[model samples]
Target chain A: MGLRRIDVCGLPPPEPLERVVEALTTLESDDALVVVIHREPVLLYSLLARHRFHWETTLRDDGVFEVRIERRP
Target chain B: MTPGPGLSLTQAPPLSVPFRFYLGAPLFALLAALLLVVQGPDALASRWMPEALAVTHLFALGFVTQVMVGSLMQMLPVVAGAPVPRPQLVAALVHVPLALGALLLPTFFLTHWPWTLYAAIGTLGFSLAVFLFAITTSLLRASAGFPTVGGMWLATVSLGFAAGLGLLLAPMHAGLVSVVVGVRHLHPVWGLAGWVGLLVVGVSFQVVPMFQLTPPYPRVVLRFFVPVLFATLIVGSLLDTSPMEPYVWSLLGGEFFAFAALTTYLQQRRRRKTRDPSLGFWRTALLSLAVCSLLGVFRPFVGLGNTARVDTALVILFLMGFAGSLNLGMLLKIVPFLCWFHLQATFLGRGPVPHMGMFLGDRAGRRLLRVHQTALFLLAVSLLWAPAHRLAWSAVAVDAVWLGTLLVLATLRYRRAVRALAAAST
Candidate 1:
């Protein structure tokens, strides 16, 4: 089954930390999901850890990073 | 007031507006509101049971104060033309006692514990310190022209008086004083009308026009509201009711003028073609304010038993209907805008990342507005005949569901926006 698509545009400067965790928890996808983020993924990784969202990040450029997560169905 | 050094508009904005930290407070306040919704009707039905104090404090300190402090922090900058000193520290310091005190105060009141009283004293002192700092900073940076800022000045003064009175009344239940000094009586007035009411009125002056795309309320009305209400509250406290009637009348008249201004503004709104949840909220707030004005006239006739019910209704109308709806409506506009604003700040003119509207789907928000409307409608009905405790609780449950839905939608939109920015960067 294809994963549900969602966007994370226009969040305030504080970044949507509580939100990223919430999305990961609710999405519940076994299929690989692609998440793109601006800037470095360091802050986002820590936030994910704080909220207990296990995932992997791959840096493609200074302003672009990709996160992939797979949920057990 | 002296236009002190560093008087530039860009440098010296009001300190009352702490947009970010204050935003966090509402989440906790909403949790507290949920608890009160579960507990309120049952406690009320029991007819002044000992537990009523606990429930009242839950809403008062937990929900109301939470929102109030956060809002103060956020608005101080906008209203006073100055930012608060060490805002992060202030938030951390206040949050501990405020949250803990709300929980402990009720338990102490019910059990009559001395330690809890000591704890209460500590918390109140901490809050007093915070407010004093906020007030001082606000006065130092305040500029001319904003009536809302003037209202805030009055609110700060009233808070000091209210806090002092509250401290005195703490000894009443312990029989330290001969007569029951009526400090607790002023608690609601200071809290409800003085602080929250004044601030909301002040904000509505700015928000209503901007959001609805209407003209500002008349300058005369704006100038009169603060002075008239402050005089009424002060004179009424010092003198007997006979002399204070005119001031009270003035206060009510001010509120009516505000309501009328809102109605007039709504009539001329550029967005008149829409039936959004925000519009539903506007109607609810206007209607509630009108009812509250009528209640003010009948307040003298209300007996002790009827007074509690009537007062509770008024509180529900003002706090939930007026403050609550305004909060929801503003969030609808703010959250999405913030999301988009942050994402696009760096790329101002370079690329084609959409405006704030592009980040938040207005159509999707419009659909969610229906859910909010439904929840609010059920909430109003539940308040009227809160027959069983569970019924009120269920209303809260529905409201939580609505909140959850909004949270989900906000997150999805936020993620999509980030991805879009990332794609453009690459």
Candidate 2:
């Protein structure tokens, strides 16, 4: 399984959301996308679930938000 | 394929539900300014004047509270991950009674019509009870530890206390029961400092970062300060009822100062590379908050001028300057963001989608913020020179109209964009 990572920490809002959506569309079934952001993308959680992407998010002690997503079977 | 049971966090209410409330809020602001225009300087003379009561409630119930209801409905599911059941029905039910009651109560205050007051009580009370119960139930079901979520709980409790006191006052106003004059202070104390204040603080924790591109508030402050603020308000309320307190007011003043200072610090530390129109509103608001807190410190000692005038000025500073400015700032950001978001959701991968930055005209936003600042400046002048009150109200009316026009334009553009994308899709 390949792990793809994207860091959107310094990017503006819609950019981060757009990049993640793009990544999801092109991602392979075995691959998981890891998104590192400066703050929690609260809106994305709903969108991901609606699109049937199982995801996990945790805020690191370093104060960055990390979200992992993969297509659900 | 439909996902069952656990998809509650993913449920987004129809955008129309929140948009309806947003649209109502500006119209209420228009009503408030026009009411002030009709009432003239008398509205600014004493907080007890019938016109004063009307205008105050109009802003509190109709505008400020209206926006809060809409924002909470939008945020509860998306931000807190707690979905309201039948959000559209709930919005419809609350909006009707709340709007009508807000209008009628002020009219009753001005006219002293018993039936009007009674109807106002019924509708306003029902809406508050339903709203509080609905929101609180959903918030409680969410699992814990987000400071934003915790702030909502405290603010909700404060709303209950504030609403109860406000309702009880109606009977006293109607001569049904004798009420304590000192206890009357509890209504605004919990309502403004408790309900409005905590809610703002809670939302700020999330918003400053998202919209302002600020860093997260210090974790310790987030975890502890909101509850601390709640404790101070509760104690302050208790002391108002007690005769033996020497420092009750001062203690509350201290907490407010700390809050104001912390918020100012947060604003200063924001990392956004470009300046936005909303920042002007926010900076003015933070400055007003800091000034209000300092004024509170010396208010008891200032051996001041007319008591009624002083009280009115405090209200203006706290409500319009601090709270209202922040509300407008968020509206500028959120309204455009939502318009873009809902329209974007309908976009099929056909034509190039419009950028979020273009959703709201930057020049138009800057102009409205200028109008708002002009209104605030005029209000401050009105506080000092009574003759300027009419001009202040006019400025406010213009500001409201400007904002309403912008919101309407954006909504239209959003609709047109959605239709174009739909046609292109097939």
Candidate 3:
């Protein structure tokens, strides 16, 4: 499945997180998401785990971190 | 400032000169490589024209090696999810000293200036220290399950050894070492093949796929090439110090396998929709490599008639064709992307931002590509059948023009990107 890109800033943390999960679950989309996170968001790992997402993270040379998450089957 | 929806502040901002340095470095190296071809076989012999040594060092130390160092500082983290330690400081310290050392090394050797040699050694030493720290820090931070990452680590270690070997020999110009066997023979091979060659191959394994958007290299090619090259280099170096025919075989075997791996990867590339200019560069390079390899095999039989010509050809092929061509092809892609990527990131969500395609500036690139191709053609022809001095000098003239034009275009593009970012910031 093709990937989608989403940003995690400005919005309240869990709101965007929950919205991502609910949108994916409702549509049952198999698409993956590439998320851009600035600094380490508090409880971000648990929130992802609670939503049962699989993710890989990269910390770029420029100090920004990108986290890729794929929807569960 | 509202970042356009597709853009984000989180995108990694590209460093201007580091990126420009990476591009500019290779262009300068290409200029030097072409000059060597025009200057003929005397360039390689230890007789050492001040100009020739300056140009050679320009490519080896200033251009080729400099590009690799700058590129790794930027790329290693992106590929390996690692952070370079004190990266700005590393870049800030290394670039100027290395350039100055490269500038002075030729003068020192030419004038037989003791102080200049000392200065060269000191500056080169400082640059090497920065390189070592950059490589070590990046490796330590890398979460290395990746083969490319492993290859880079090996290359970095090899580079350290090569630099040390060069330092050990530098004092020999004054006959201080008492080490009779010419270390010069080992220096180029160690620096070019062992250090620069390994790094290029390792990065190409990732970049060819990433940029061309092609499939992964064949499993066997990736898995075996690195180990085989490593084994051969070790065994061959040992043999250089001993009396072993088996080590010679090992080295040749390793080189042949490298050729095979490169060929396989290029053949399988999927970006075959049209006649790519990059392919033209690569084809010349590959042909050069093949010729150089064969010359190595026939070194003992180079006959007095062919000795000068063959030696000249080998150096030209390796330096200009293999290293220079690959650098040109990759830089064309890298420079544009850095421009588009950084520009787009700033305007993310706020307004319309141009796509990568829009930012490519094909008209400008085409002019540079044409000049580059003309220079390459003239150089190859000059190497092949140039019985006339005029023809050879013409090749150098064309190459110098090419470098000057490239530097201008790259500078303009860099300025454009910076302006775009500044405008967005305000």
Candidate 4:
């Protein structure tokens, strides 16, 4: 499986949302996108579900949120 | 991984829920400005003047509270993940009476109409009761551990006290209840410092870092500051008739000063390095807050005999300078963002979506900021120079019109974008 990583740690709202949405458009069926962000992207979860993607969010020791996203089987 | 708490994007209220309040707020501001223009210097001459009270409520209830209620409805769901129950119905219940009460209360003040006062009491009482209940329920339900949530809790409590005290005072003024001198002073304190101040602090803790890309406020400050301030307000209110009043004012002033200083420091450290007009508004707001804090701390020692002019100056600085400036700045960011956000949701990748900047450009924001600053400056000058009142009133009127026009234009632009998206989708 291919892997893409995007860091949106400091970008404002909707920008982070926009970038993630854009990345998903180019995401392959077998690819996973990893996003590093400043806060838990609560709003992104519903969008991911709507688009048939599954995500796992982890809070790093450094207080950043990392969301791993992939297409649902 | 633990699931995010207190936030559900799906629960976000319909855009109209907040927009109506936003649109309504500017009209009240315009009305206040017009009243000032009509009443001239006499209206501003004393805080006790009926015209002054009318204008104050127009801004306080009509503009400030109107915007705040709408914002809380929007923010509670998004930030706290606790959506207001039956948002559309609650919003209507809150908004209609609030708008009515805001108008009626001011009318009562201006005309001394018994019916207007009684009607205002009923409407405002009902409106605030509903709002406080709805917001308090949502806050209790929110599972978020964010410091902002705690701030919201305290601020809501403060609103209860402020609204309750205000309701009591209105009846007392009409000889329905015996006047309590301490209650008279406590009402504005609870409203401005407790309700308005705490909410501003809380919202800033989230937005400053989120929007400006600044470092988050120190965790210690975030956790302790709001609650401590709330406690101080309670203590100060109780001690209003005591010799300790000056000390309490000094402490309160210090707290506000620290917040203003901290915010300014964070903004200076913001990573964006871009020319943001919102920054100008924020800076002006912080500066006003800082100045007010200093005045509070030093007034007793400086022996600036509490003249009507001095009292008016402090009120203007707090109301127009600090709260008004901050509100305008936030509106500039929020309106465009909401327009963009809703449009994006509607389009759902079927077509191109307009950027936030397109709805309200930076140039327009900067122009409005300049006019607002001019108005603030003229307002200050008018207090000292009697003849400058005309110029000040004109500036305020222009500022009000400019703000209202900008918001309307932004909404119109949002509609156009929505139409374009629909056409493309079809």
lDDT of 2 by residue, A1-73 (tens): 8899999987766678878866776778789999999866767765676656778777799999888887777
Tens-digit lDDT track for model 2 on B326-422? 8888788778777766654555234556765566766777888899999999999988888988899889889888877887887888888888888
Q: Arrange candidates by TM-score, highest first: which order? A: 4, 2, 3, 1
Candidate that would win on TM-score: 4
- Candidate 1 TM-score, C-alpha based: 0.69
TM-scores, all models, native as reference? 0.69, 0.91, 0.75, 0.94
**Candidate 4 to truth, TM:** 0.94
**Cα RMSD for candidate 1?**
12.7
lDDT of 3 by residue, A1-73 (tens): 7777766533422234444444344333577776665433323343344445566777777666677766455
Tens-digit lDDT string for candidate 1 (B300-398):
544335666666666666666666666656556655654554444333333454555554456756665565555556656765767544554455455
Tell me the deviation in Å of residue B114 in model 4: 1.3
Supply the global lDDT for candidate 3.
Answer: 0.60
- Candidate 1, residue B283: how far the Cα is off, in Å: 2.6
Off by over 4 Å in 1: A1-73, B1-42, B45-50, B76-80, B109-113, B173-181, B240-276, B301-305, B345-389, B404-426
Number of the top DockQ candidate: 4
lDDT tens per residue, model 4, B39-117: 7898888776788878888998988888888888988866887778889999999999999999999999888879999
Order the candidates by DockQ, highest first.
4, 2, 3, 1
Tell how far residue B344 is off in model 4, in angstroms: 1.5
Q: Please state the Cα-based DockQ of model 1 relative to the true two-chain complex.
A: 0.02
**lDDT on C-alpha atoms for all candidate structures:** 0.57, 0.79, 0.60, 0.85
